[model samples]
Target: MWGTTFNRSRSEQTTVPCHECGAQLKIQRSCHEVFMRCESCDRIYDIADYVAEMDDAMERFMEGVYCDRV
Candidate 1:
């Protein structure tokens, strides 16, 4: 059930630089959200990329921790 409306009342938010406009964009945090739009340039960005990046970082951190414990 995909919808076009987004609730702006959520307090969970983060600021990230827009890829297209280079302006600070407010991103709402949600597990179901797959995409976000920049308010400045109206450019859309895939949220999966950010998630993948965080996953990769966590993997590396865990690997480092395991290596240190060995």
Candidate 2:
């Protein structure tokens, strides 16, 4: 039988400061895809890319939404 496993890391718990609004960005959920929510900007970020740069940028940009507060 084939099975799927789910794992989480410390970064998943990382509430980074929003680059726009300065609010904390939190990890909402992770599965086949990862979802992050910015409370300050009220934006939902979905990270489906496996590439390193794109993934990092998406996370950073989403976090920035909170930082910029827009």
Candidate 3:
């Protein structure tokens, strides 16, 4: 995460489109792992399953990964 200084607006967030409810899925990272979570339906998903659907948010999220290495 980018700590408390950075925050993304709804339009800037990643949207994977949940299979069950058709809601947008959010990309989340925890303890060195990244995954997809659907807030609307309360479901967790493997990020690998939707790599191809990644968009701008994915790029920004991954950027944070290497930034945290410092």
lDDT (C-alpha, whole model) for all candidates: 0.44, 0.45, 0.68
After superposition, candidate 3 runs with Cα above 4 Å error:
1-12, 66-70
Model 2: CA > 4 A from native: 1-13, 46-70
Residue-by-residue lDDT tens digits, candidate 1, 1-70 = 3223433332223445667787754444343443445678977666544443333323332232322221
As a TM-score, model 3 comes out at 0.68
Model 1: ten consecutive residues of lowest lDDT: 61-70
Q: Which ten residues in a row have the lowest lDDT in candidate 2?
A: 1-10
For residues 1-70, write the lDDT of model 3, one tens digit per residue.
Answer: 4655443332234766987788988877765566778889998888777778888887677655534421
Ranking by TM-score: 3, 1, 2
- Model 3 is weakest, by summed lDDT over 10 consecutive residues, at 4-13
Q: What TM-scores do the predictions have?
A: 0.41, 0.37, 0.68
Residue 34 local lDDT, model 2: 52
* Candidate 2 per-residue lDDT over residues 1-70, each given as its tens digit: 2222323232343345544576765554432435556677986654332223244434544442322222
Report the number of the highest-TM-score candidate. 3
What is the lDDT for 28 in model 2? Answer: 47
> What lDDT does candidate 2 reach at residue 67?
26
